[model samples]
Target: MVDIRIPRLNTNDASYVLVEWLVDDGATVESGASVATVETSKSLEDLVSEHAGVLSRRLPAGADCRPGQVVAVLTPPSQASPPPVADPGRPEGGGTPEAAPVSPVAMVITAPARALMRQHGIDEQDLAALGRSLIRRSDVEALLAGPPAGVSPLVTPEATPAAREGGHARPAG
Candidate 1:
């Protein structure tokens, strides 16, 4: 007899919604066969069977499944019924404590860094090469603190017409 437990896909995920069952109760399922579909906040994933056996019982679809929750029980063909699961709350080995719902803080990279990276087609790895901390706006500003040693600053459209005319009037003596 084997118990199938709902698995946690991510650190911040607390529960999954059972979307559908691919296999029916009492059906003989092969090992590694997808038995059910579960939906987390990020994506939908299929749950696979660990052993080849007859699916004895399955929790109803649309149920909220927590990590380590036994969603189904499988019985070998030779056995009419499998033994009841030892603990419904704990998963196998009983070593991992039940996980509490996790609320992680969202990280927001500063607008300037995001824009600069986008414009330059620079990836996170490339930004790291600049020796910047890569955490906040100040880090990005620090990276841009000075221009490249040999390169000179270029004029932009915002330059005044007189400046564009190459300083029409000479400096006062």
Candidate 2:
């Protein structure tokens, strides 16, 4: 069994909330796969798995977890058991579900960057040529300001007008 301990955010801090679980508890995970998202007072970070095994969450989302706490447990394949509860955050209830598809060039982006992408209907594929693995809000801003020639604009012209005006886009009536 492998214990997934939460790293101390800082010497001054005692605990942090388990903001979200990217993978459901009792799911089979691959090494280096992003397993969850954690937040500190300063920033958000992804909890990546180091071993390929069955992941079992020890703490629920929104729980206050201390640094070096074993937030999860990993069991070898033959000894793994089904998760005991429904995970509303996941679609299939429990077990390691397949990871969401992401562009090869896309890194796990920041929340603000994600929000901006959602607002503009832009996907990581749209930014592939930028040659960046980790994308930030500033990068999105710069891209919106001007994309290189030949690259299609991320937002539609109609949506652009509304975005510029600080309003949301509407479907054509």
Candidate 3:
């Protein structure tokens, strides 16, 4: 009988809540066939069987399964135990850990701020570097509070006539 252990789908921090079992006890399963669905904090993933055999024993659905815990046992047709693969994508003796990929940072900005940022062609990363505590709509407003770095303050439609006609006009070269 092959002891089909619940493979660790992720790092130690990850714990799975067994959602449901797709196959019932004694059900014949093919290699890499999904046997159960598990839910983590981020997503739901299917737990697939690694051996082609009859599922002789299994844990019921809704069980809180941990990494390296045996969730089921498969009785192979010919062999008593399944042969281990040459490279299981793990260390030689198995169970050595590897580093996880880092995810990109995303700042939560308000809808209005998003619109304003798009309108102004402001790079969010550049604004993030401005040492603001929070990237809120008010922060964007504060950035707009000052005149743009190289551009003069925008004149309202009401002030345009006076500003255009008599305001500080550039001297002739």
Q: Of the candidates shown, which would achieve the greatest lDDT relative to the real structure?
A: 2
lDDT tens string, model 2, 1-173? 99888887767667766767889776799999988877665577788888889998988765677888899988998898755554567867654566688845325465667677777756676666567655667887787777668977655544454555777644321
Question: How close to the true structure is residue 126 of candidate 1, measured as C-alpha lDDT?
Answer: 38
lDDT (Cα) of model 2 = 0.72
Candidate achieving the largest TM-score: 2
Clashes of each: 0, 1, 0
- Compose the digit string of candidate 3's lDDT tens values, residues 64-95: 77877788888776744453345556555565
Task: lDDT for model 3, please.
Answer: 0.62
Q: How accurate locally, in lDDT, is each candidate?
A: 0.64, 0.72, 0.62
Misplaced by over 4 Å in model 1 are 81-173
- What digit string (tens of lDDT, one per residue) describes model 1 on residues 1-173? 89999888877779877767789888889999999877666667899998998986557766778989999988888985653455645656675555679864233343445555444333454345444332344554444444466764222222323445564322222
TM for every model, in the order presented, reads 0.46, 0.47, 0.42
Instruction: Rate residue 130 of model 3 by lDDT.
Output: 53
**Which pairs clash in the backbone of model 3?**
none
